[model samples]
Target: MPAPSILSPRDGSNIDPRSLLSSIGEVVYSWDIHSDGLQWGPNAGDVLGRIPEAALNRGLAFAGLVEPGSGRSRYDAIVSSGGHDHGDGVVYRTRYAADLAGRKMWIEDAGRWFAGADGRPATARGVLRLERQVRDGELGAAGNDVCDRTALIERLEQTLGEHLPAERIIVVLIAAIDELTRLNDDFGHEATDEIITEVQDRLRSVMRRRDHLIRYSSNRFAILLTGCPQNQVEMAARRFSKAVGQTAIETGRGIALVSLRIGAAVAPEFSTQAGALIAGAENALAGAKAGASDTAVIARRRQGRETRADEPSLDVQAVAALNERRVRLALQPIVDAGTRQVAFQEALLRVGHGMDGPFFATAELIPLLERRGLVRLFDHRVLELATEFLAADPRLTLSINVSPRSLIDPEWLDAFLGCTRAAPGMSERLIVEVTETATIADPARMAGILKQIKDRGARIAIDDFGAGHTSLRHLRAFPIDILKLDGAFTQNLRRSTDDRFYVRTLIELARHLAVDTVAEWVDDELQATMLCDWGVTYLQGHLVGRAELPQRGDASALLHATG
Candidate 1:
């Protein structure tokens, strides 16, 4: 319209800047030497999502946009030259205008200094546009399409595989739009798509140039931040939640207030595998949605089902009740596969104010107990109850769980050994089961503890075996009397060949190690039959039998009553 807003040629030739700009990318710009002002071509405003003149006049300079250490700062380096020729072109990266939500399309600027009429440094000119080398594989010629989840995952896996061992912490955040289902039903897919696009913009605005955003699913988005510091993971998570949930979108129908549930998992802490990390983040996101509105949660190591210390409302008084001996015991039978008779019963612990009060699930109870530093005491009490239960029944064999933390506690260990030594034939009837995923970091020390328990004539069973990275060599080292295969392997044994193969391998290894194998989570007759065929010594789960408390005057109950 106005001579196409081309920069004035220095060599008395009308070299259209658009031709040169096209070669590089969008938006050609120049700095006037005489006026010390910035100017850009016609499409600059559209490319930057800003009023080109206002953006430059407000001192929102290009160099200011350059991320720190994201190449050389053009202005600083030019200033160092004292208005002289600054040699060759310089390249740098910058984001879009600050006011634009989710419009932080990173620009790759490459410009050069040119001489004025007086042969002194006057104008600088170059082209700027979205970096074509972006590794996320999201951007194309149009720069409008959202990235697919599978491609995003592949990119992430590739990035992690290349960048791991650098000791850099990366974080993956999965965010779900709150009430997306309702939005879709009420406003139709078009309105939902608009809202999603708006959300995509907001999410894009908050991330750094290096971070990535992908439309992970119908209602969820995933952002990956590389080189994130360890301390800032929580802050980053909060930012993600706030960016999406802080405001409402103006739709054609009306104002649509969008909220988000965000889950963040930092790499090498949650897991090193890409799939595992994504799964962990999704799990945390589910937890956030299940709890409060607009919540953000960090994925932690999966300890137990719905086990987390960060629940919004924790009943501390319940813990106090537990400390005051308000607890209950239940026993689940681990049966012989062929005989269908109880070979042994695992003592399960539950907590409540009294027998009539609401009892918490073990998964929920154990985490809270561990967080409150009451696990040692709780373990001690459970051990006392289990020892008493064993002492009352000559024919009964009871397997009780001992927290690995208690093994390291000298006082607890002393009390445990003393209790076992005092009872008649108590050691033979008692089996101390240690969870395989316990904090038995020091294998030699754990071996020592296992040997000590075995020395007292009590058998040692490794609980939740094959759930973690414990090697077969390490399993061989433990003085284990039994191996309780983790329930995960038994989850879909009938359909999953992988699980079946893994289970078979574990059973074979157990046999070689001279340890009896107990398959846990055998939920149905089909799975039970398969386990028996595979030569498992014991099968335990709901299908076999639910956990039952012994009746008063019965073997376990009499001992519990006396205690």
Candidate 2:
């Protein structure tokens, strides 16, 4: 469908554009560049606030209607009085004058520049859509309960738009109380509310008189700091983090220690759009939560609105995709080096439209899942699917990858243990593999989780072992059943003596630790032969058996081929 043309003769139009737009939940507006006056459509009052009939008759100028600091320069640069043809469009949020009811309103204005007769930019005519409005009294003293999320965002946008030119940096921090929902479930809503109130009070106490603190949602807070140096901003983030992290809130239930995941973004000098700042902060917050607890990350500039692999973060669609259960397993056999028999198959996740359609690799999906705090959910689903596969094929022993983030999630770990417990002897046939680098955050906690899984008869493997910063100390800490040598070590084993020696040393260390060693990416007979000579128990790669979507009819044949 073609988009409706906004350039339909400005004068002598039989159909009223205002009436047309109002019918579709919009308001038609025009800015006369020469006079600097903004002409509002009939329905503008509905969106912009109930303007007095006298003010509407007098004609409201653009400067008077728009908040002083909001996009004035862009409006001046884009909408020219010289009548030049520039096919440029802008989307921004702005504040307009109050209605008769004396309430401030925020509206999103999006419009394209149009040329006058002289071929110079003359005016910008666009639509005004309401975002949110708040009465002046709503933003009471700091002592009162903070403004709602919508109103707080509106004020932040207004403040940013107003102050961008000052060249002063404003730090926007988005603090999300970690696992607030779990608190609600465990302690009850009353306790949750009390904890939230106490946290808010603590935040208020920590903030300066000039700083603005808002209860962004049930579990998040938005903070705006003006005129703070970069060092001070960093210190402030750490300060708030420590204050919240160390203290325990006294709810009716008991003392509850709450952690915060904070994301901070400095206001861009070139642009002060509140949405951009919030988005940057959001991305940073996600990064902090994905890795170490009580951490802070500075926001990076995004290329555009949508997030892709090349971009710095994930988007709403990617986050939703992880939760939709549109994933399937692709099985690859891990063969015994000497006997050339199938030891087990690794179940890799493929996400897409259907079984045969194009799908995203785990490489692409992992970052997105981690960013949105959905890795645990994805891991949980993978386990569920793996269990189904195991149930269907009693002879099959499967190796599945688990995220370090999921291991730290107490609820997910408990549920996973429960699932493994349900099938009494199923754990013996399951191998849980975790990347070596992923255990860097808190090895003690990860080691404990691995121990619990091991106790249930499941074997734990330190996958990609030689590729990361794994040490002898870590080997001693973790109760690992297998050490999967990284493909990097075996990929060059045939050519490099150092690679061969490293693999030998790792194998000897594994032997001493009483752990089996598996060499990955043993693609050829030569690599397999060499790894086998080093006493590596298992070998995995394309040469052994390429990963395939498991079909019921081919299961027996696959086993025979490996045998």
Which candidate gets the maximum TM-score versus the true structure? 1
Report the poorest 10 consecutive residues by lDDT, candidate 1.
1-10
* Tens digit per residue, CA lDDT, model 1, 273-358: 88888878876775676565354588889677684677534447556766677766678888887777778888887676465545
Q: Which runs of model 2 end up more than 4 angstroms from their true locations?
A: 1-324, 552-561
- TM-score, per-candidate, Cα-based: 0.46, 0.44
* CA displacement after TM-score superposition, residue 342 of candidate 2 (Å): 0.3
Model 1 lDDT at residue 470: 62
- TM-score of predicted structure 1: 0.46
